[model samples]
Target: MPDTKPALSKVSVMQDLLKVVAPYRWRIAAAVVLLISAKISTVLVPLLLKRIIDALSQPQTLKALPIYLLAGYALLRFSSTLFNELRDLVFSRVTQRTVANYAQMTFEHLHLLGARFHAKRRMGGLLPDIDRGTAGIAFLLGVGLFTLVPTLIEIALVLGIITSRYQAWYAGFIMLTFLVYTGFTVVFTARRTIHQRRVNRLDSSAKSRLADSLINYDTVKYFTNETVEAQRFEEIMRHWTEAAVANQKALFTLHVGQSAIIACGVAAVMLQAGSDVMAGRMTVGDLVLINAYVLQVCLPLNALGFVYREARDAWVNAERLFDILHERPEMEESRGMPALSPGRGEVVFEHVSFSYEPSRPILRDVSFRIAPGATLAVVGGSGSGKSTLARLLLKLYAPAEGRILVDGQDIARVSATSVRSMIGVVPQDTVLFNDTIGYNIAYGRVGASQEETVGAAKAAHIHELITTLPGQYDTEVGERGVTLSGGERQRIAVARAVLKNPPILIFDEATSALDSASEHAIQQELNRLSHNRTVLMIAHRLSTVVDADEIIVLEQGRVIERGSHEELLGKHGAYARLWQLQQREDMDQRAAASRA
Candidate 1:
């Protein structure tokens, strides 16, 4: 197991965040400068007001009130607003670009992770985490940086001015008040985090259940379990509703506690200022200035309290995403590994062994070789490890006991991307992206020209059907090609593999979903596509592999018989038994269909 670190500190999180902003350093520097300038302008406005008030209180000087001071006060206020807006304008690009970059990096990293990780994690749950993480990043960049940092600077400036210019009592009261307010916010916000995290988890669970149920809607309808699904979904929502309420209550405690602290601080300052003014020791301008400073300081503290609370949750969400990025892939790219070198398309598996879980071995000491420009078919019953061989050859899972080689290179030593580039597969289950028919086929070979796409479709016997659709080649294949028939979808998958035109091809039960007529048509196309290429065909139906150059019957991860179509049948072993069984099933199916 990988080592886990203790909870991360806010400062540590912030330091890590700097790496993301490093590319946009100059813009960030500009934003920081603007922030300081804006705060300086804001601080000076109250001081200008002090001067204006003192001038007005003196009857003799009122007639000669300085217009420049009055005008400068207005300009400073406007400049504060202008500088803040300009700061946001500069920083928006940094925040947006950083979010996009991190999102893209996460996407690529997920693809790099092992298939095991995807199998264990639900797609619905994973997607919401990603969305929340990006949103957290945005909050930190825009609100936390802009609001929290500037609020601190403004507070420090206010405290410094009060201590130097006013009586010690004024500064002391403000400091004590600030410390009390901060202490309360820190303690109560910490308490709120528990509720916030619960809310996040509940929300994620609800979304996960909803998405899973929707994805399996057909199964639910077939089983008539709509009410059961609805009740299960309601259970998740009930938990979420309770969590939200608890979160709100915690928020109420934090805000009310903070308000009480601010009230005490403001009342103390006002009482002291009133006494100083009545005793003729201070001017009315001093009283007004103190009042203005109190409001300025405390209001931001309120906003800062809320921001700090929200930022903690944001940090938690972002950390979850970062954790996923940190996961190690099952297969690592060897440093300086060269790409696969092209040859005669020979594949060799030497004493390969593998298991999805250690307790249940899927393939044991499996050895096989396909000569260059040859077709080798593997036949077996369900769970006999036939498909596992294809997965091992594709390098989806590394062997536990042996190695696989492609074109004389140990596949484990070469880059997987390079290995897959030379091979094409038509999976047992055909799933197309919700896109145009042409786009799905062209996905096999990115940058394939329009002519090449249409040619491959025509070769697969799908071009004529596509042309008849209202949108022709541009017709949208609804999600997972639900709009297309089983045969139509398989034909599209065939077209994709054909367009790839790789040196090796794998058809894993490629025609299992088709009718007899469609199967005959598709089988002919598959044969033509397999010509002059190394092919590994895996099928449960014995008839599919009867014409292969060589055949191997695997039973419980062991090859029990090997020969040509007639040679295996002559033995009357596992291969012959399977053929006889399938032949009888075919006859029965034909009789049943005719009767119906």
Candidate 2:
């Protein structure tokens, strides 16, 4: 099925725009006053020129030359320019503030959105929409407000003057020309919209492909598929090229048709005015005034046609961005929800059950507890719901059937930010921001001091390694910490968590990415960091959990064994079997190492 949504109504888009402009209403009002004054001066300039031309044509009027009229005409032209510039100067603030406000709102809302939404969305697609949306807001505020509104005002004044002073035929012909020009523009611009929309879609897709391909540059090089990736991108670009050409052709047709209508209207008005002058019913100045009005009114219509076309695409882009703002987070809390205040870091999963979908349950009636300042290890096979427990505790996903509590308070009643703020986590694959080593570590605590950051690094046993580097703590960790080895990145993750110093901590296979030597070395640091903290250890390497206070072996979302290492080993059940298997694997690894 094609993914299509109805575009927002024009009234809704305008209302949203007005809301952004609400704070700057006074400035906007002032700008409008200046705009009207400017147009008045502009319209009167043509009248003054007409008087000057008339005076020049008559020998008696030319003797004095009416110096005041010429001076007034020049002054009016200058005032028009001056008022227009002043209007822009006042209204530019509204445009800038409105765009900045919307952009910031969008930024905050994107972060408020759920993990599922972000996981499904492409960064490349959202970025261009955001950029275009802000640009659209600027255009709507600046050009749409100034150009479209002023043009309509000028046209109305011209039509009213003609209806009041000239023959009915002149007014009738101008109205008819306007209707024809407008109808042609509306119909042609609507057709052009189809091509513009296609161009926009292809442009977004091409950006997405470019970003995706570059992010996976290593994978592409490994598979030697650079040519294939380039070919795919070229295909998207080719489609965009064809759509752009079609859009330009439609624009040309629209402009040419509008110009023809205006020309016919101008010719009809001029011919009638000339006939009146020849009949001695009107002066030569009357003909000149009529011609000037036609040019003034019709010239702005050309700009109107262009603005109308561009505004359609801008409207579409802005609507798409506003759609993102409308997306409600999956786990948004109530407005007055209380923050989580953990006294002892006591975590309890009471009959907890969860699933991404109804039929695919990841955890079923699973329950566990960790006493204050105690360590509970969860050992499980892949897809056995170990990580889901950590995510649930983090409030990234809520349990479908039961409640999770911290310090006897149901987490559902507290804010997710507060819940997250009270706990620290180190996941299996640590993805660092492309920043300095010190910056990535300090991210764990928002306002940690430099000394505290270094202390955390030392606690994580990475300080010595960092000191050996050329830039030390200031060295740049390239995208996702690609410049650092897996062990180094994992250590940095540990340093971050250590810096946070949360009462509740979860090590979700924290050492899984490390080799035997690195794991053994970092294990000491992990042990030290877990001291006096309530910890949940989810691991596949059973050897690391041997000294854990309690071990729960999970399989298919069910806990099959729970006991200490020796006690579970004595049972000869799931824990024993896994332990024996890992024991043999470890021995084989050691034997292979010895031979090498």
Candidate 3:
């Protein structure tokens, strides 16, 4: 689960939205003009109806029909729809552009965030948050601007007509009805927002669970835990279903309450209008007018209620998105900082100290220097911080205590991107994109020609194997390159490094997971790759580091020994003990194979 930050307030969310919409303010103004025109036209429809009715009701009016008034009535209705359509057309660009801008910002921000941030987040949950947030922005902009504003304008126009042409009491009664209905809607929707948030949380949880299970599909199959995975997924879905039902119930209650209030208000207004007509205080046309106005006002009140509720939900969703934008990237790239100056890849780690958490230190006062084109290997057991050294050099993390100098420039003073561009890394596990082999190789250097790509592949000795495949270099590598054998994937990684041709390279346990034959083959390629490049090799097996220019033995975050393999073996210290143990294990394995 990713760390959850406090959500932005509704006002803050609106302010952010305003900034996104600022570029298209002229279009928004045009839409507003169209909106006002539409509402004015809509208000005139009832007025026209009242006039037509009064004309027909007159006894002498049978000979001269009110053709002009009838035509105007139809025109007003058509004009209202036309204006609304134009308003949407004018505003569509702003809405879509705003969504696109925010979506791209959030996407880029996620990439800018640190490794720790990603390590703590589940992609399944993060993706849904972004999707809902963008959608929420669109909904709020559309409904808040067009639906809510238009409804308010229509209400005001209808109320002004009622007050001017009829008794003050009628306007007062309608106003009171609106106030009560709005008050009820606000209170109920606020409570329902709680339910909506819960539903959203559970929905994210279910998605995260599904993604996690599927990502480890082979692990589950090997452990025969299909039932266990299914049961866990069902548990999350069961909670989601309950939350969804509760949300629906809240919606139903809100809608029914709104309808009941409108029904009572309409009934009372009609009853009073009927009484006034019977007493001859008001004509039939006036009675018809009040009825039409009341229905028109009340109907949009229902829509207003819906739009208000949706706006609240949209605010909730948008807040989640804004939370991502609010997250400060761990390494803030300062403006005007120079990129790393190109040099002979001289790397120096000076008394570096670091800890992911304060209490659990991974490195302490570690110091080393690798001159250009020299290979330095750090050999250690599983928790010994060899990998952390590589990470520090790459600028994935900044050392808590000393500074790292690459080409005599403090990496902290230069662009992290530039530092990374100068180095090529072949991690222990090579996780490729789910793309064609050619595409994956081309990722090493953007815009590399086919000849260059093939040359690099051939240099890594994987080109012949790739050519034998049915689709050749175009063959699709499944998710994370799982379709390829470990050796094949390692070769692809080497190919990528070869294509990059960086001045410095880091091989972090590159052959640690392979069988003896595969390890021997890949080791040769790795040695070839290391030629004429500054190399940092982090290895678990002592045998692999014998040929390194210098071998450092790490034990619990400290360098226990440093020497050439011959010097360390002559000394008969920790390095010698590890070498003898590995040699015995290798001989035993060979003997067992011979016996078999």
Candidate 4:
């Protein structure tokens, strides 16, 4: 959802803007010198009018008048053009560099932030904020600070010249009145523009979230939740529209106030100058200079409002983007991490208790151990902590209490990166990145050979499908592998695991959502894959894992039984009852097929 409130203001934003430009400060300093020099030439041109006016009123001296003024004016305009060009080139380079660096830093930090942070955040809140924030920084520093700052400095310079060369009281009067006019205009305009920016931020975020929902339209359709999701999206858009309309209304009021004040100030200044000339106190040149100078000074003052609008917007984004940059990652072991190497692949869960939230345990003092090369089949109902145990062993979530040792070293005492590198997991819903088949298969290692990738794909029975495609291994799988069937996606997951060749393997309901034909093909591949590694299989289809070396049956986060299928059946306990239930389900499926 869109954030309803503005996170920052332009006044607060410009204060820290220097940090974004700090790395390029030297270049900025050089550019500022050029910009200021160029600005002086433009500012001086109006004063030359006073000289031209005096020459005309004086005794006609060959009227060298027009020629001299034209030459001097042309020279000043040329120099202004040269220096301004240099300033533009320098500022463009610096601004682009700064934007690139900030965007890169934000993206890098997002990747390091781990899964939990992503889980809590909305895409609606993140992507647009970051994009806007980075673009704002470029505008604020490049134009607002560099371009607008010099414009204001030139105005003050003109005011200084007017007070010294003309009448001090008159110059003071002009400065005071003009300042009041522009100041009020800027303040009123800022309020409206700021509101509009906030509205746009909300609108952009809602649209992004809607796009994400559409990308997963299959899930919405399958669950018959299309109408529900469409209504939710409409609700967010309705609020966005209301905010936008209010902001536009405020902006219209601001423009009216600003235009009237500027027009009045110009008219008042010219009238005062004309009256002085008529009274014989001021020369004809004085009127011409005053008219031109007023327009020049008013340009930058008016632009102040535009700069303020962009500055406020840039800061709003900066706050959100920085929030991601400053976030701490999930608790990672900082010290005493032992080396991870191939060992027994033994998994020992000793009094392991864990909870995502305190006093709300997922696994309660659960304890179990499996030797190297042993197949451990975990069986339980939903939320019984079976998958939780597997995740703990893989170090996806650290156990709240007790320890899990692999190769006689606690998994917690080893670097998560290395520990996870040696383990392969096949999750229930197989997810594939948008990449070529070759790249996805070779993802387990950065420098895998084509031979290895193909070999792994062949073992998983997906090599045939890849070869049939025009590009073979080079074909791009569409987003989240949507171009592939459920069975095809699962086989790709198997291929990835085969490529990884980890000492430990986990299949968490890997084949539970497949047709019988796809299930049987994948089961054969899985059996071959578990040959020399420690395997943990969590499945709803009990018959598939009937030949597992050992089974640890859980009930409400507690392991209640452990043995082979035959041994458990002989005991006529939980495993026996489960086996009977699976047989009934198999018979039902067959009966349905026969009736059809």
Q: Give the TM-score of candidate 3.
A: 0.97
Clashes of each: 0, 0, 0, 0
Report clash pairs, candidate 4: none
Cα lDDT of model 2 overall?
0.89
Q: Write the per-residue lDDT of candidate 1 for residues 1-596, one digit (tens) a residue.
A: 23334344445556667888898999999999999999999998889999899988886846665899999999999999999999999999999998998799899999999878887888778888999999999998889989998999999999999888989998888889888988888899889898888888888888889989998989999999999999999998998999999999999888889999999999999999999999998899989999999989999888888888888889778867877877888887767888899888999989988889889888888888899889999998888898989888887888999999998999998888888999999888899999999999999999999999999999899999998999998999999899999888888988999999999999999888788998888889889989999999998777888889999888887888898999999998988888898899999999999999
lDDT of 2 by residue, 83-150 (tens): 99999999988899999998999999999998789889988888998998899889878998799989
Query: Candidate 4 — which residues are off by over 4 angstroms?
Result: 1-21, 56-59, 63-68, 177-194, 197-201, 219-232, 332-342
> What do the candidate models score in CA lDDT, each in turn?
0.89, 0.89, 0.91, 0.81
Q: Each model's TM-score, in the order given?
A: 0.97, 0.96, 0.97, 0.89
lDDT of 3 by residue, 1-596 (tens): 23232233556667888998998999999999999999999999988998888888886857777789999999999999999999999999999999999999999999899878988999888889999999999998986769888999999999999999999878887888899999999999999999999998998898899999999999999999999999999999999999999999999999999999999999989999999999999989999899999999999988999899999999788778988998988878888889999999999999989888899998888889999999999998888899999888888888999999998999999988999999999889999999999988888999999999999889888999999999999999999999899999998899999999999999999999999998988899999999999999999888888899999888888888998999999999998999999999999999999999
470, model 4: CA deviation in Å? 2.1
Candidate 3 regions off by >4 Å?
Answer: 1-9
Regarding TM-score, does 3 or 4 come out ahead?
3
Which stretch of 10 consecutive residues in model 2 shows the poorest summed lDDT?
1-10
Clashing pairs in 3: none
State residue 289's C-alpha deviation in candidate 1, in Å: 0.6
Better of 1 and 3 by lDDT: 3
